[model samples]
Target: MSPQPQAAVGAPLSRVDGRLKVTGKADYTADHDVRGAVHAVVVGSRVALGRITALDIRAALAQPGVLRVISHLDAPRLAYRDNPGAFMDPPVGERLRVFQDDRVRFCGQPVAVVVARTLEAARHAAHLVRVSYRAERPSTDLTAPDLPVNDPLPPQDYERGTPKEALAAAEVRLEAVYRLARVHHNAMEPHATIARWDGDRLIVWDKTQWVQGTQNELAAVFGIPPDSVRVISPFVGGAFGNAARVWPHSTIAALAARVTGLPVKLVLTREQLYHGVGYRPAYTYTLRLGSDRRGRLAGMVHGIRAETSAYEHFLEGTVTPGRMLYATPHVGQTYRTVPLDVNTPTYMRGPGYATAAFAVESALDELAHELGIDPIEMRLRNETAQDPSNGLPFSTRRLRECLRVGAGAFHWDRRAPAPRATRDGDWLIGTGVAVGCYDTLRLGAQARVRLDADGTALVESASSDMGPGTYTSMTQLAADALGLNMRKVTFRLGDSLMPGSPPHAGSLTMASVGSAVQDGCDRLRRQAIGLAVGDEGSPLYGAEDDDVVVLGGRLRVRGNPARTETYERLLARNHRTHLEVLGSFTPPSEPERSSMYAFGATFAEVAVDARLGMVRVRRMLGVYDAGRIISPKLAESQALGAMVGGIGQALLEHTVTDHRDGRIVNANLTDYLVPVNADVPDLRAIYLDGGADLDAAPIGVKGLGEVVAVGVAPAVANAVFHATGRRVRDLPITVEALL
Candidate 1:
């Protein structure tokens, strides 16, 4: 199909749902008004590693408005079937079996649930339901000695020439260890679920990224057919990654509803967020790079240790870019998962790339300094036009352009080379830059497009918005694809009753689900065209099907606007009611052999107080080559939001757990800081002009959601290093570290 005019794809269109959201008419999961819904509060274990000895629910059951207290002892028996495919990581070994057997592996594991008429009553009753345990010392440290190491893959060693020999042959070599603190997905909306059972059918309204995943999990838990359960999540406030999986709280809410025979609503408190869901596991990365005096990289080696829960093995893509980023004859990486006494960790924003980029980019910057070379020049000299891992050409890589544009925009030529040379009063001002990269991921997605004779269109998919404007972008794409105005199109999502679609993650929503929408709209448009041309009495009758096209809500010839007729007029003449088409986009079985990734360059300017040890970001700019952008406004919003999130990860966010009792000390938002409006200033994003291989996907879009955040931390850290001459490897670059 030939490309249509860029009416909605590249236009800076505002969100279609902006009015609904701003007017408080959009319905989130918690906003659902389920009649006769009772509140349920969870009672968590106080110890991290222990055996629950006794439980007392007598006082809680006697409280006013308290309906029931359900624990493992009183809860209904489940099938306890083990299915690894059901979850991202299967429930293996003694799965804390909520309330059944009290062998707590982590602190805040649900021990009991209190159901009552009011949220306050349930909360108070939960506090009264006491439990005792036999506690043991827990391993909270990521670098502790007793951490069990699991080998996810064999030694990923690549060598065209010996790296040791290359290092010895090279004139300059730089090695450094980078530490990243554990970061939480502090999304604005907390995880919540309202579960009810009607006979054998289970209906749940959950705040989740994957509605089908939750349905599958609930089916497995209850040993019921998956078709019997329905998961509805029409809106999600924000889910960085925390809502990607079904947590224990969700299961507890379902159990509470089933046991008490009433609709139960559960909302996790801020404190429970620290232990209930997944987080970005702390990482300790050691990197060694060998480069010549001319700044050509000869060899590289990386060693990484990431934290995981004792019960399950969690692994991230820590070694992905190491094999493909630069051309290195000798490269070796050893990625190990260190099992600690904590809940399993999952992907957070950029996941492994964010951690890996910090080490790799920081090491590259260090090497540039060692060689006395400009960082941009050094990167360009060592840039690989093809994927070194598989030897495939890039689909489209303008990383060099990104660097050039960013350097010009950031005034890199004016930066002082020496640390602490630029000062403003008591503050040291320095600028730093780093490269960002993330893979272009595509998954199977389905969408339905319906065009009525009334000149209105409706698009439905099971994908999620999650505060990234999925509804608005998909609506815009549909409006353009079907030749209808934005006002005449309605996009519906976040409900399992719609056509099956992939989860909204991996930055693939636009490429995957949006492609599906395009397919559906094209099919619907063609059906309308067929209807117009097939009728002998119609104006387009006897016209070649190939020459007929739909635009501006009219059936017209490709180049002749005089022979055009409005869709409503055509439909009225033909006595047609409506045209509907169901379309799906499954990724091609054989993708073209190319390095498909979204790339960017982040430049940061930081101001450091020499006396009080404070670091503040003055300005930041991100230059991106993330394929064809569908909505420029939303894309810019996503980039800016990611930079803000990166600022939090690099400076303020940390889930501090007290190892003495396995309690999270700073779980509340008041103690755990995030970047406020006053903390972030003057951030901008610039997207390059171009699209990747059109054959890659229908929309020719590479994922951009995660790429914006991949390089932000390192840029800020590099700036801090240049500002105060202090090389802090750990995250949050605390005031104490600067002192």
Candidate 2:
């Protein structure tokens, strides 16, 4: 078949849904209107690690418009069937069972729920219900030496060569500890769910990243057939992996709807979101490195400890970078999870890689300063030609290019090698750089496309758009593949009935779902070409199929533009109203032949007040080797948003927990600081032009959203060190630490 014309795929197009979003016309979960829907407010426990001694709901039931109150005493028993196929669920332990028992594992564990006619009534009644608990001190500290912890999973711990012996014989050695505070995903739209039951089938409007995953989870929770549940999530305000899992509140909403025989809507309060959803778990990383006199790495040892709830074990790709990022002969890693009296943590943006980069990159900088070598030079010396852990060649490894391009753009040649050597008045200014990487993950996906006789088309998949422009990007791919104008194609998503799709996180939506959409459109276009060429009454009826091409819904010979027929005329003459096709993309499952990953380099400049112990980021830039950007405008948006998040992680964001009672002290947005307009400075991103990674998927694109955030925190930390000549190991380089 002839190659389709390239018109829309790489064009810098604005989001198709931008107008609806800005005008408040987009319907998020809470905005959905449900007939006869009641409101529910959860009542939480006051103490962690306790058992409910007594409970009373008389006052709550007496309130006017109060429909019902449910607790362990009267709440019906749910099926709670096994959901082994749920996405990203912990493999070791069971999920929390809402209102099933009196034992409180953590503070803010929902003990009861109040249902009423209006949201106001639910709020008023929820506060009226009384409860008492037998409290005990909780183990909430990751640094506590005596805390009980589970042994690391096999994948979390690794070894290569003889690291200990090599480290002992190395000429130079450095050891440091880094701590990262727990952080929450403070998306603008709160997690909300509305559930309605018609007979035995369930319909749910939820805030989620994957509608199909949510539908399967709800089906398993209710012990019903998977087809009995339909999850609809047309628009997600923003979920950086927080909404990927099916939380207990969603089940609670369904349970209340079943019990009351009325549709129920539950919206987590702002404060409740802290304990309601998952977060980026705090980490304690101890790193020891050995290198030659010229700053070439020889060996490395890593000790990782993180927080997880006692009920389940959670792990990330925290130790993978140490094994593969650099070309080291000897590497050893050990990871453990400290069980705390808190909720289970989930993936937040960059997940494991961000935490690992902060430690590894900062340590490389320290080693470079010790050996009197430049930071960029240090990283370049240790760049690997193949995966150190598995010996597989890279599909596309561009860390060197990312660093070189970023240095040229950031003007790193102007930076001083010595800390505290560059200053302007009361401010000490310095520049720092770090490399970031995230695995290019691809999964099986499918999309459905339909072309109408009216010269328009519709493409759909069970994907989602949390912040990145999934709707727009898919439309671009379809428009290009089908030889149609962008305005003639419409893309739809976030419904379980459309087609199967992988989870929206991990930066794989475009590589997986977009590829499927492209395949479907390509097949539909070929079908049209065959139909036009075979019809005796059509123009250029004897034209070879390989020499024919479609553009603007018109079919013509390769060299003759005058002999062409519009899609409308061909379909009308054939007495066909529409054409439909299903597209699929399944990644190769054979043994690994290549290492696939997306990489970037981040550069940050910071200024520190000499007398006030304050650090302000002046400007930041990131250069990425993410292959074949489908939508340049959306890619820029993703890169800039990730940079802003990195700024927050480095200097502002921290989730403070009261260890005594396991309560989040900074549950509200006011106390949990993020980068505001005043805190954010100039930021820019540049995507290196490169060929597609055909090994990754048909789209030939590597993922972008997560890798952009990986190296941000460490770059800022390195900058602060350069400015003050003092290295702080912990995150959020606070004024107190600086002092």
Candidate 3:
């Protein structure tokens, strides 16, 4: 069959919803206008690791506009049925059931909720609700030597061959410890949920990336059927893996509505977000990598530990990259989750791969230096077309291309090889490079398409756009597949009532949801063509269905453009109101023959102040071999944002915990440092043209969001080391570390 003629795919088109967002017409969770909605504010515990001995809310109840104060003392018992989703999944022990008990697991744990007619009254009443806690020392310090080590569940911890013996016998050996600090999501829109219950049915206007996950969780908690609950989140300001789960505040909002017989809105304050939602857990990773003098890897051993909640285990794909990234004969990895008195962690943008890359990529850079090899050349030396971990052929591995393209684009050859060799005024300048990779993960998803007789189409799925341009991309896919104009195609998401979709995460939406949209549109177009051809009254009725092509509301014979009929005319004659179909994409049942992954190379130039111990990233560039480009403009934006996030992880972002009380010292944006407008400068992203991972999906697109961030932090860190000749294994390479 001939390749589909592309009209919209890969175009640098502007976002279809850009006007709605800029004009303030888009409705986010808290922006939803609900009638007679009351406000709810949670009162958090003051002390860490304690139980509420006594609670007092008389003053709060007496406050004006305050309807009721619900606490563990008088709160209704909820079923809190188990939801074992891997994304910040509930604890194996009892999940943090709202108001189910008086136990406090950490500071900022909700002790009570004050509901009122107005947000002001709710805020005032929440402050008035007093609490007394029986405090105890919290084990919040993850860096402590005595923290218990539990095996990193299955598939995460792996061993092959005699890694220890191989390392000991290797020609060159290098071992280093890398530390990463806890970091909050700090999405632009704080997690908000507005919930209402009527008889047995419930409705929620919330900010969530996974509407299905939230719907199921709410259904289980209320002991209602999944169909009884509806979740609508059509727009999200930005959620970098923070809004994927139904957090405690969402439950609190629903519970308050159930108790008061009125709709309740719960918007977590900036401070409340520190604990109310999920975060990237701090990790201590020790890597012992052994390679030959030519930089060919002999073996590697990874000893890793990351924080988790005391009640639940939180895991990410942190250790897999170390085993699969290189061609090594003997590879061994041991990962442990050190449960701490903290909120259970969830996926961040790049999630585990970013953390692992910081360690693995930086260590590789160190090994390159030790072996007197260029960093890019060193990585090239150990490149593998087959996954060393599972012995599967790679569907697409372009690390070498990324390295070569990025080096040329970033002018890598001009840099001096030695540390601190280049200088600008008082600034020590250096350049560094690293490789990033992420598996192209696609999940089953479905989309509903309806082509109306009026020459318009609507396609929908229960997905979300966390500033990744989902709306634009899906519209492009539908437009191309259905041969409709961009204006005639409307793609909707973030609604549980729409067709089922997997969570909008792990950079899976494009491949999973896009495939469904394409399928749906193809069927709808074919159906319309079939109707026109079957109708003897219609023009060109005898033409073969295969020869017909729909473009811009006109169905025409591909071989003869003159033979055509408008969709309106064809439908009017057939007496059909619309053509509708539900399209679905499911993962293949058999094991994949090849391991699919997206690859990218990041290069960084940094300048460090000699006396003040300050570091500034001068410029950065990333070249990627992501499969197919859906929308060039949006793809670039995604890449740039992920790179910015990587910069924050490498230089500034850190969630400081007062381990003495399990309190996050920098809970709000003001205190917590992230890369702001001034911090991001001269960043560029380039994509390899027309490359597609054949095994990933029909779209042939490997996900881009995660891989863009995977190697960024290490690239910056490597540059810092080259600039100052000081290797700081710990993340957010602080000024103190430089000194």
Candidate 4:
């Protein structure tokens, strides 16, 4: 069939839901006004690891307006049926069970809950609840000398060739150890859940990336039918990856409501959020690279370690870049998850690729310096045509274009080759570049579309909008497919009763859910056109179906503009109410025919004060090769926002923990630092404008949210090295290290 004229797909339209958000009408999780809802405060264990020896809740129960105090001694035993975990769950161990035992596995583990008539009453009573513990020295440090080390799972270790022997035979070798500090999500809106029960059925308004996942997990925890639970989350302030998993606070809210026979609301305090949610785990990466005099990579060896909780093993795609990013004859890697007395880590914005890029990209920069070659030229020399891990052709690999375009845009020719040569009044200036990539993840999704006789449409799926503008992008696709004005369509999401959708993370929402919406809208439009052509009284009767086009809810023949009929007249004459279709998309289950990934290049300019040891970024630019840009405005938002986050990862963000008691020292915003308006300088994003890769998905979009943040840190780090001639192997390139 002939494609419809492009109208809204590529347009740079503002968010469809922007008016509601700015006027304080958007309903986030905490904004839901459930009737008869009382506040519940969670009481956390003070010690990192211990066994509860004494229970004390009399003081909490006696506080004014406090209805009840629930703890392990009195809380009911949940069924906790075997839940075949969600997409983000680690396959190794079970999730943390809340209030089911006396053993404490980590600091700030929920020990008790205080439910009261008001939030103030709950807070006061929770502080009065106390317990005694028989504590032991906790293993919280990943590199402590006395801490026992647990080898990583066998499946994580990988090798392609004889890397050690090849490294020994190389003409030049480089080795470096890099460290990254753990960081929290710290979204604007705190994690919250409001749960209530009605005749053995549960209802919750939660801050979750996937409402269906929350519904399934809650049903499994209570041993009830999955259909009996309903989850609603219309708007999410921001999650990054913290809300991807079903955390303990969600279960605790439902439990409180069930025990007290009242709707219960729970919101974690800022300090509690540090220990309650997951974070980007600290990493120790030791890399060894062997290269020739001409900067050709021969072999590489990687030693990686990350911290996870003792109860569970969490892993990510940390070693994928080493296996496929460049051309190499031999590669070996060992990934180990160190068991520590801390909460398990989860995926942050960039996840594994961001961590690996710092080590790999920085090593490549060092090799370029030694070989007296430009960094971009060195990377281009080792670019791979096929994935080395599987020997499969790439659906689309645009790293070369990204690097080339970025070089010209960032003015690479003006950069001085020597370090500490370019200096201002009190600062040294330099520029650096690095390449970034992320896997184009695909998953199954479903969407429902309905075209009413009134010429308006409604499209819905259980997707979410966590600051990426899913509502606006999906609406754009639907409007273009249905050939209707953008103002005539409505898009709704974030409810479990809608059609199923994948989680909002992984950068797959646009590729998966957007495709489903397009399919459904196209089908619905075809139904309308077919109806009009079949009716004997219609002006478009007997017209060639393929030649018919829709614009402004009117069906007309392509060559004959006079043959036209509005949808309202045709549907009213035929006595039809509406046309409805359910669109679904499922990725191939067989082995992938081609490797699919989104690529980008990051360039940064920085200035450093050698006397006071201060580093400041002056400007940054990112060039991305993500497949198609459905909404140019939203795409710019994702790219520019991620660059800011990358700045934080390089210079300011760190989750400080006191290992002695397993306490997080800098948990609040006042102590923890993020990039402020004053800290951010000039920033820009450029897309390669390469059309589409149908092999990746139906909508022809490779994911962008994660890849845009991948190489940001190393670019800044390399710039600091060029500016001051000091190489700091750790993240947040601290002032003390520079001095």
Candidate 5:
């Protein structure tokens, strides 16, 4: 059977909520109107790690409108239950309990809360509450964190072939240690939450990408039934991965509301954002690669260490790329999260893949130079149709196509083979390329669809749209499936009251939640068609189910447009008010027939000052083989944003921490650095035509958001190496490294 022709899915439609956002009509988490709501500001501990010695709150209670002060001394000890709701892969260790004890595991940890009638009163009262602690020197340095506390990932050590022997027998070998600085997700909107208690039930408006995650976490921590907590997050300004987890601030708000018998609101300040929320932990990866004289890999080994909190051991898929990206006969990898005196790190954008690619891609570029091979050619020689780690055939891998397209667009032919050979006066111009890949993960999801008699539909799901176009993308799916105009459909999300859903990260929203929406719309369309055909008064009473189709809210026979009936007329004749249906998508429990992942190639052009050690990215291009383009405009935006993130990772962004005290020194935007308009270049994206993965989902899309930034940093780093005769192993290749 032929695929259904899409009218709105691939079109470059503007965001459906763009008008409301620009007109300031959309409501964010803190913008909602909650009756009898009050302010709640947190008071963080000053010490990096130690025990709280004394806490005096006499002056704070004297302040006007100060309802109550909750701290470890006075507050009731919570159940502090354990659950794997906040992206816990295997439930390694216990999660942090707010105000449960006096031990400060990390700096800026919340120890007390100040609740009042107004935000000003809360801020003033919080300062008045004096806190003294016996500080202890924290082990905050990222060089070599404490190891082997707990490893949730299976196969903590993996060996495919005789890697040791292959390395010893290789003709050419390269060994280096690549370091990436600690990074933070500086989303546009700060994390905010408002928790209200009514009897035994709790309703919360929060800034989170996963409402179910917050609900589960809240229920687990307080020892309440999961249904008792309701999380609502209709709109989010921006969230890469910071809003995916249930942070300590969220739990505090709920606890404060229940304790005070009033609605409590909590917002994290910019300084607290550095330590309160999870950030990409700093990493030190020592990689050793052995290849034949012709640039063919003989063996590869990865020794890695990353930072995590003393309580929870967080881990990601950092070793998967080294084992699978390139076809090596012998491979060994060990990924360990070192326990430290810091906050528990969580997923950030590409997460483990982005960090791993920095080492692998950069090493591949170095090996190509040793063999006198083109960078792009060097990767193509090692590309395999099947995953080397698992030996499964890829459902659809277009990495070769992406590289070819990006090379053609970037004009890869006009380049010198030797480093420092291409110089334009003061600026040395050069180009570099790298490949990126991400496994397209999918899960079961459900949605509720209601179609009114007036040719309008409302779809609800427990999902989120944190800067990505969830509202717009889901609307397009419903519009195309039901043959209704885009304006006739209204999609709702970011509410726990809706059907259950998975976390909004991992670029799986389109494949998982989107399939559910399509299923619901299809069922609703079939109900209307059945009503028209079964009725004797209908124009096409004898038409078959497949013969009838919906078009512009009218039911017509496939061949005869004259034989048509409007939904309004049919519903009036049938005496029906509306049609409602439940749609669901359950991913196959059986093992997948093939490996599925999204692939892309990033090309970067850089100009470096040979004398001054200055690097400027003049322009860049990305060619993606991400399965299908759900929304053309948003897909392009994802590409551009990923490129920007890549630029920051390569040259500018870093979270500086005072290793002596384990305090984030550069917490605010003024102190920390990010890529601004002046730093961005002429960015462009090209998605392959008909690049849909039918095996992945019904919508034929793999995932775009995560893969765009996977290889970006390495691409920029390689470009810098080509411009100047400098091979910097550390990230943010600073001026000192070049000189």
Candidate 6:
């Protein structure tokens, strides 16, 4: 019989910081107690499009404890430079400098900031701060024809055979338009920043996903060296890509600190969150698909129009899956960004894939229904073992296996063939499934590892955990590589002072940062082994390097457990103080011929009430081929969390903007509904038991964070379609649409 695997890589270990988090010991951005910190609240423009005509700070300044009021009229002018590195994108139009100019391009734009000794005083003073603006009608609707289209990223176009020709000859074809509403990340934690300057150095505790990016931006804004800025974000409540960029509030906090000469804390009210940062742009997608009577896809043409701010062009990867996912020979795609008087959009979880999959997967389901074919069978027939776009073989693709496993787990054979056929007590019960796909990306990461003479090891990096068990995963990797117990290893991150690391987005933390930690620990262990084996005073001096193995913090010969010496004993005998190693992992330079991506299939069972336009997810099952599960418990939690987020996207999450004045109607949580505890249903997640080729990264692990939600919305939408014959292309399938 085979022996049990070691308790390291694949174990169901709990998060190392779980206790710290649950016990309120974790230090999130706003939780820090900065000495002599003052509260600052921002005053927003009431008009969407306007230029400030007059500024009144008399009442606000007279208020008690009001330290200062900085507006475009009274604020000191610093050198405003056009640096793309500082902003999310290159300043679209001479950079709308906050407080530098009085022109408001969008509603809720920060017109001024009120700093006070107390939070209440700051709130009162902010309300007292008044501004008059010369108003102008703004174009807020993305669908408006007058909106100018812009291309920020390089134009993307892919074609195999002429889609027009194929569609002309095809036996059957269907074309439909799909629209997705603008959505906010709406992370549990609102954007917060506490800025302080010590001499010439700037210290900021911010809730951000990219610490280095924030550091660079602050340095550029302050016209200081990058080393002079330090950003610390030890814990983040949640980002969902909202905190990925250095938002305008961060700059507001820094400016306040600079003006007041004291640390200033700026926490965006839930209402302010809607306009202060980025969001997933509203999208309009037109899909034309042609297929045979047997439901085999022949051709596809996709046209996309998404929203961006007038000042900056925000682009999402709308054309990616169209080129790579299936075996269609004739494919064409065009993606356009429509700039409106709104805040610029940024990368959300799964970004383009999540939005694109909704249209692609929904279209495929529609085609299957038109051909009178099973959706799973249709996908199976069109599955390409190699990427159809580039004609390159995948390192490892288990999407077919995922489908088979998911179908069995979901009981696809039991699904009724016709829409609205299955019902239970006025609830229409239907099952639907869709494919999930996301590219595996890795960036350069660095780490420092030190093994003390006391037999404990410490690992440090600048990467963040972001509620993904980063600390635990890195600790596990380091412990295994160093041949030490998990208890003897400590992993620290989320500080700019540590070793340089990549941004903790893109699901690349494990593949990139984990490799660096493993490399550093391995080097440290090898150094200890050399010292122990080479020294005459240490035990096993004559042992071969290969024969000398370290386990349980002890150096011993293979097959001789009793003839061993503790690492502490050996180090003390050799008079070696400690072993330290620094290592880095950089991604491959050249682009590969084939595409490597994590794949999954989500099956959702939904029960929709016929009379009321209410939908409830009854059960969800996700089968994933994400390569080598590191921690089953945490992976399951991640999958479940993503599924819940997808549920919100499908049924609840939508940011409503009052286009008349460009104010977000549903800015707070009460008005903008998300999934609550009562909305979540039974969720089951399964990871295929295997490993992928180690060509991409040393860990042979692919990313699973974004992939979990890529196809989820479509799965729910397809189920809703199955429950009711009427098709709803719009997002947040509301009761009005169903009625």
Best by lDDT: 2
CA lDDT scores, all candidates in order: 0.85, 0.92, 0.89, 0.90, 0.88, 0.85
lDDT of 1: 0.85
Per-prediction TM-score to the true structure, in the order listed: 0.97, 0.99, 0.98, 0.99, 0.98, 0.97
Ranking by lDDT: 2, 4, 3, 5, 6, 1
Report per-prediction Cα RMSD to one decimal: 1.8, 1.0, 1.3, 1.1, 1.5, 2.1
Model 6 spans > 4 angstroms off: 1-5, 80-96, 151-154
Off by over 4 Å in 1: 1-3, 80-96, 151-161
Residue 388 of model 3 has an lDDT of: 87
Question: In candidate 5, what are the lDDT values of residues 39-126, reduced to their tens digit?
Answer: 9999988878999999999999999999998999988778767776556363367777788888999889999999999999999999
The window of 10 residues in a row where model 2 has the poorest summed lDDT is 148-157
CA displacement after TM-score superposition, residue 525 of candidate 1 (Å): 0.5
Clash tally, candidates in order: 2, 0, 0, 0, 1, 0
Candidate 3 shows a clash count of 0
| Candidate 5 clash pair list | 627-691
- Model 2's lDDT to the true fold? 0.92
Task: Tell me which of candidates 2 and 6 scores higher on lDDT.
Answer: 2
Q: In candidate 5, how many Å is residue 607 off?
A: 1.3
Deviation from native of the Cα of residue 629 in model 1, angstroms = 0.5
Please state the error at residue 549 of candidate 1 in Å. Answer: 2.4
Candidate 3 clashes between residue pairs 3 or more apart in a chain or in different chains = none
- What lDDT, from 0 to 1, does candidate 3 have? 0.89
Report the lDDT tens digits of candidate 3 across residue range 467-493.
999999999999988887899999999
Which candidate, 1 or 2, would have the higher TM-score against the true structure?
2
Indicate the residue-level lDDT of 210 in model 4: 90
Cα distance off (Å), candidate 2, residue 666:
0.7
